[model samples]
Target chain A: MFFIKKNWLTGYITIVVKGAHPELFFQILAKHQIMSWNIIKHDKETACGRIKLADVMKVRQIRRKTRYKLSFGSRKGLPFTMKQLNQKRPLIIGFLVVIIFIFMLSNLIWRVDITGLDAEIEEKVSQQLEEYGVKTGNFQWNVTSPGNIQKQLLADIPELLWVGVKRTGSAYHLEGVEKTIVEKEEPTPPGHLVATKEGVVANLFISKGQPMVQTNDVVYPGDILVSGFLHSSDEEDTNSGTIVGAEGEVFAEVWYKSEVTVPMEQELQLMKGINEKKHYLQFKDIVLPIWNFKQPSFSEYQIESEEKDFYFLKWKLPVTYTKKTIYQTEITKQQMEAEQARKIALAQARRELSRTTPPKTKIIDEKVLHESAENGKVKLTLYYSVLENIATKQPISQGD
Target chain B: MKKNKLKESIMRSITQIFDLPSEVTLKLPRITTIGTIHAYIENHQGLIIFSSEELLLKVHQGHVRIKGKGFVLKMMIAQDILLEGEISGIYYEK
Candidate 1:
């Protein structure tokens, strides 16, 4: 009878019997090893009982041996429940579709809100976000994290002083501060314009000061090129002088010496614009290559891989989608002559010197002081003359 | 018939001496009743008749008739019958 309890999973059927002796039919069923329970007699000729669904066929076979009429009343259990569910296929499919729809909706970016920025900058940020796959209706997993987006935004948009990116549910909120340029105000105190570096004055413009040095005059650091004191030549007394702030430009020629070394042999790797893409799905530490299983036919290549994580609502899934781009590279080795190497070294030294100088400075002259080729390398020591503004404000002491 | 009776008596005596159950030794039906509401019969041969008010089952050498109100067979198997109702009486007929 323990198997009878297990029969509930297979199923059970209530049977109704109508005959002169329905109970006799059940007794005969019991004798035939077809078990039944809960036998209720409705009248003198009708009776009903429950039998395992498996015994229905045997019951039908035995029914022919007697004049009793047997009919299945109701079927119940897991098998019948499954059959009923199968009958309503559309309903179940609709339920599954609704669940899938909600899941997709939860993982999509619903809105992108940019605040605290001008319309121009906001439009630029929006365009940049679209380029990064952060626009609305896009899958959230396809976009980088908010911190990464903030870093990329700040790097790409120089006008953005500070930008804050926050992801709340399915919406992206960005707050940015624009860089404001402030104008500098001059000092009201009476000051002299002194030479900041040792140079020969190439040009001089005195806007509000008396010129103390002429063109072509060599001046040392801290030497006053323009004085704030105005002394009238007719007045022999220098004690009564008008003191004012000096405003002028003193252009002078400055000199720089730099040394550079260039190797006679150079090897460079250049991309040939030929690339292949491979895609992979990563679960934990396991990487499953999904697309482009064949390796690219390239001797020298570089691989650039980008990984995007999946998220369910606010939780990050362990699975990640990775895209790898393999670019073929060509390496070329160049053997240069000693003269060519020396020339390259001189140009490199001049370029280095100019980079370290002021923005408005001009290179007036350059000369190779020394050049030598040794140990497969060319070394050059070069001198450069640059014309630049040398006047620096120095406040005067009124007590003196 | 006389020899069968003598064998039955001998077996009954032997069961009594050994302190054994008669239902197991003599192949007799064992009927258990819970108050006046339910009756459970084991080692029964067959069901003679059954209705809402009465049930008759073939036991060892006789028929056991159960007269009750609203009699329902709670379970029916090869060797056991569980009857549920208001049991008014139980009679054995040879």
Candidate 2:
């Protein structure tokens, strides 16, 4: 065991000694504290033995005193093997380069797949990913985490209800569900149609209800215009009547009054469509501008900035990319006559009324009740009469 | 010669009485054989002759000769020699 350890560390060599009684040379070497092993006498004059490489100098000195001729044979062990490897430098370097290249390739995004979505939405999602620096061939460290990506996808694409982002090795997988607008059909119970506003009934289209009020009859809020009960109250057997859900439309005259004020002199800021874009890389609290070093020359401008985080694997790094767009704007002031201001105020009031009303409402008449101009402003009071549906479902209770 | 003989006898008596090893007290060669395949010799002076079928070593007062086939010296140190072969016989000579 000691010989094997020494042979591997310092190395060993086989030597052939040629002379009369060559074995005597090895005995002399042993006496000098230089151990030899595996001695074989090939012939009377030739013998071979293995000796440690460290004892070579001692053997040479002993050779001067003896007539035996010595020649070194095969060499073995770690030192020689290392020397041979050092001579082949290119092979070792090439092996290291291949290992590094493989490691880098493993950390890159090779493929991106989006599933459970339409082709249009899929393309939109991929484009959004590219904008976020998550495209194919991009380094995985430069892209944010899957959770952040999922959130960004949901926020940017309105058509997506829920989206899942998964990273598997060198690939990115996305599964999404599209938002489908579905109209709900509510189950209407046996009930009466009541008036939700104070108005006069202009028209009635009772599909499945008993009409309680006729046309041009005035009704108040909470008043039942249609009854779910088939029998009248004067009937002797009111409890025997069958109750049904009231489905109908009762058009009535609805009125609205509004007061609006408009400034005679108006100031507005308008965009000139000229803009500059700047990009920055932020590391913790330190921000470094990467592009668009020059500031915008416009005195009045608006800035819109967006920041994106960077990640390595599942960890969020303290680095972000910011993009800012500066838009040039101009302020303009205009003076208006009282008549023009009054017209604007009236139109504004009408718009407000229509916005607050339900769909399918018809504006039958509009009038400006009062108009005046003071302190560089025009104030107007307007009234509108609209024909709209006034029927509301009121479920019937057994106790009632 | 007579005095040397007397000293040798005293050393032998001391070894016997003290239960000491003869190889150390008397400067004698101790040869251990494992079946017929290997022979380990300790306290040997030097190698006298070696061949494919025989090995001879100088011991304390004489020479030790071993007759064998395919004889090879497995290892050789200052005071020990390990010889491996098919051993046939061993002989002592003055």
Candidate 3:
């Protein structure tokens, strides 16, 4: 405690005393109760030592009594530094002002983030918030209450099912849920069941219409399979049939033909582990690259980068360090066997047939009708026979 | 001189009977060393001689002579002196 007080408050000074009998000078200093330390004799005539800055006046009084020559060297300690700073008052004031300005600015919002919405809906929401005077770069104190904003948002957008507004520090968060719409069914006019494609009838079931075609009958597209009109039992009466909508199920055999060709020779691309690296410093949006003199010579390569951001506590600094790596790739051609090509074509043909075929179809038969090879390519033509419902409703016209 | 010797013997016997430290009871100099690199002497009278190769300190009864190379008087107060150097030997001369 005493050492700290001596070092920072009263401070200290080194003094060089040049005179005959310098030892006597130290004796006089000790006699006067002035503390001195680090006393060293330079030669027969000169000596140096340290004394407290407060004892400089005592040294002057002793100089008159003993007539010794004394000169001070350097001044030390925290007090002396503070005195030096006192001389440059304007610089200190400017530094303090800058610190206060930074503190004040940090208490205001600088960026606004909105997520969990589509681009068009996000734009609309942003525009709506702008009308409410809530936007980026705006002070948090000027914004309306979060509850009021949430209520207003729910009222303005009819499609929204719920809304939430939360404020954390200087950032305001607004989120909403959109309502799901349900579709209604429209009344269908009276119609008849017609054949949508040419097929051989395999099964028929009439529910609300008269059957026109029976099983094992071959019909073309646009042919009526079920008549919507019901005939009365009384044959002598005129206008005996009543028109209505047709409803029935007619199963038929439909054929699918698909042709696919696969090349015997193909190219393969492979990536080697050979890569080049570059490092850069990201200050905000600006990138300053280092140690990167030339671009990589690889014609085909993939670029991958990793970035790490600097942060202090909960605040993320705008500075980031990024490392980019470029991996080399090579492409080579190879020959495929005939059997391999045939297997690939068959798989692709089956995938296409399944994609085009309607749901709930029962496959009756499937075969590769023809196969041909020319110009390093193999082609296969496939046929698929299936039984599926082919009945479709056609509305009756006024003239009919 | 005979009377002073008798007084010293009396003081020594009294200190031994009371188990008092000699540095306080007899005004003896206290010397501490740290692996030959540093030496601190308390209750020292004055600097007898100082040099890069050797240093001598005046104590209560005799003088302590420190023989070493690169000797420096690191700190000095009224009765305390701190010396730093490669100490080779230390002895008292009456």
Candidate 4:
């Protein structure tokens, strides 16, 4: 028989009885307070929980001891790990968190950078960076990778000399130099100047290194006019730069002035009172202007203002205004007065002299070489030359 | 406000490193007569809930020992809590 709960007033009992009297045991269970009844196969000897009800139910040939086992649902007991998770469920939730800690610490710039710069150049690299995209807190808004953004910015712009972009935690860093070309160079340490031709030295002006020839000295080709060889006092034992700086041979043209003449008709632009404003539009090599007539109303010229714009680092366009006084030339039958001819000749000589002269030098003298009449006008030919010392000489250190 | 969030995240990492038991968080209203701190805490995918007056939790030798007063545990009850109070320690048995 099966037992349920702990109350006797409720619950049905399944009774099993032996001794060939199953109906008799059922009758006795019904006489007492019983809820329900169900009888199954049984051979009872020992007393069990349902053995008290077996006296009423009777069956034939009942024997050995049999007992009832009570159970509910299925099995119990689970894995200890599973049980712990069920208890502390919050811990499992915490385990699955994906952290972008790297983004969190991206406030500071990584590498401070400059590119295309020179050490002693007039323009500073650091100044360029401030003007460009390199600055603090500027990295926060970058949608792309910081390094990639820096590279693209530099590649797209030509003003930058070089670029180096990097980052550290909260900081994005930039490092680079501004671009500059080298022009001036170091001294030609110690060297000798050699002769370029086979001739007597008429004049020697030393610009750099040592002059190996003197005035009136006969020199041959491949001979030393100036020394390219140099040395330091401490390097007396040998001519190597290990004890000093480098010195090498270099040769340049040296010359004295000879008479040269060019015939020219002076056209002096004389200005009258009339004046007009002229405007010009020029993009590149092409010139477009409002003025067309080659003959001007006046010739006194003055520049007003000029403006320029550079686009894409390629095209540079300029706009300029020029004001000029206009005048007319009258060619008439007039004899050349001595004073006027002499003045005109002197001015012509001055122009001829200046053409071959250096910018900072002055004409020393002028003399008439020849004179002739051309097209009813007196033309004077003159011999003129300028005197100036343009020789470059860099002496060895006197070491005072 | 951003600085406050950063500080809060830093505190979270610190707590995880040291394995803190439960965080007692509170927001103060303009005026208060009832208890200021909300005792309810969520756990395990919000499948379980916990509310207690005084919670004592310590991790020793990898075993989590949870002790508290006026504890009310709910949903996915894994461990049986021994309670000694007039209040309920577990709200749902199933």
* Candidate 3 chain A, run of 10 with poorest lDDT: A308-317
Model 3 Cα lDDT, one tens digit per residue, A304-383: 88775443333656876787898998887879898999999988987776677667678888898999989999999989
Each prediction's TM-score versus the true structure = 0.57, 0.52, 0.49, 0.25
Q: Which clashing pairs does model 1 show?
A: none
After best superposition, candidate 2 residue A301: deviation in angstroms?
A: 45
Q: Which stretches of candidate 2 lie over 4 Å from their true place?
A: A119-124, A127-133, A140-169, A182-400, B16-22, B30-39, B65-69, B84-94
lDDT tens per residue, model 2, A219-268 = 99999999888886688985689888998999999888889999999998
lDDT of each: 0.91, 0.91, 0.79, 0.40
What digit string (tens of lDDT, one per residue) describes model 4 on residues B1-94? 8997787677667777777643422111111112322123222111111223322321111122233444332111112222222332322221
**lDDT minimum window of 10 residues, candidate 2 chain A:** A308-317
Residue A172 accuracy (lDDT) in model 1: 94
Name model 4 segments beyond 4 Å from true.
A1-185, A189-208, A216-224, A230-269, A276-339, A357-366, A374-400, B1-94
Task: Write one digit per residue (lDDT tens) for candidate 1, span A35-69.
Answer: 88889999889999999988899999999989999
How well is each residue in A205-318 modelled by candidate 4, as lDDT tens digits?
555444555666666656656554445556765345332222332222233233322233444544334455554555556656656545444334433333322221222225
Candidate 1 lDDT for residue A56: 91
In candidate 3, residue B45 scores what lDDT?
78
Ranking by DockQ: 2, 1, 3, 4
